[model samples]
Target: MPTLLETYIENRFRVQPNHANNNETLHGGTLMKWLDEVGAMSAMRFAGETCVTARVNELDFKRPIGIGDTAVVESYVYDAGRTSVHVALRAWREEPRTGEREETTASSFTFVAVDSEGKPTPVPELEVGGAEGERLRDRALSRDR
Candidate 1:
């Protein structure tokens, strides 16, 4: 098994016109698409298999991501259950040229492990070592309550 950090990579994508609403800001649908995709990737790392969204606790679009801004979505495995994984997802917007960044949206999503045939599959026990791991695990667990 690989260290959690080894399996983690921040995903960055631009907020294209097609992803925007008539007002030119990123649509809610677009934000969720990115969140779900990144969250699934995080869960797959811990599950070591394909995963599907089981629930999305909350999706807060605190700020708007406008056109010409790059949307940076960061996701990482934070906690796990017998057959489920929790992921912390954050979206940020940065000016394409100057690199000014600000958080635009945030969400936490849960995913369940699935076998090749798409049935529920058991996942490995989470081994949260070190201070950072402990912190992330605590945060993820807190979200359940």
Candidate 2:
């Protein structure tokens, strides 16, 4: 079994001109893509199989990340079904020099584990036993409200 913490994944992307809109802020599509990638990685880590995105819950952008800022994306598996893994994802904008960071986005995703034949496959039960695991799971669940 995989613990919730064991499925956590964090990645950083430097926002450049190509990733920005005319306003020079990170594009929504770009951010969504990053979120999906990170979410899938977390799901795969928990399932130990290839995971394909099944659904993306509501995503809202709270702030804009300007070009030259670092966009940090984090994701972890919070719950799982027989073949579906639920992941919570969040993104923050950070000033590289100052190390100041503020959350910019949040969303949840569902991924289905797949076999080599691309059919849905069962996954092991998630272990959310320890204090840290429970805390993380609670945090993600709270975001639902």
Residue range 55-89, candidate 1, lDDT tens digits: 99788788999987899888878777788887888
> Best-fitting candidate, measured by TM-score?
2
Write model 2 residue lDDT over 1-145, tens digit each, in one string.
9899999899999999999999999999999999999999999999999999999876989999999999999999999999999999999999999989999998999999999999999999999979988988999889877
lDDT per model, in order? Answer: 0.82, 0.95
The lDDT, on a scale of 0 to 1, for candidate 1 is 0.82
User: How well does each candidate superpose onto the true structure, as a TM-score?
Assistant: 0.89, 0.97
Off by over 4 Å in 1: 1-3, 139-145
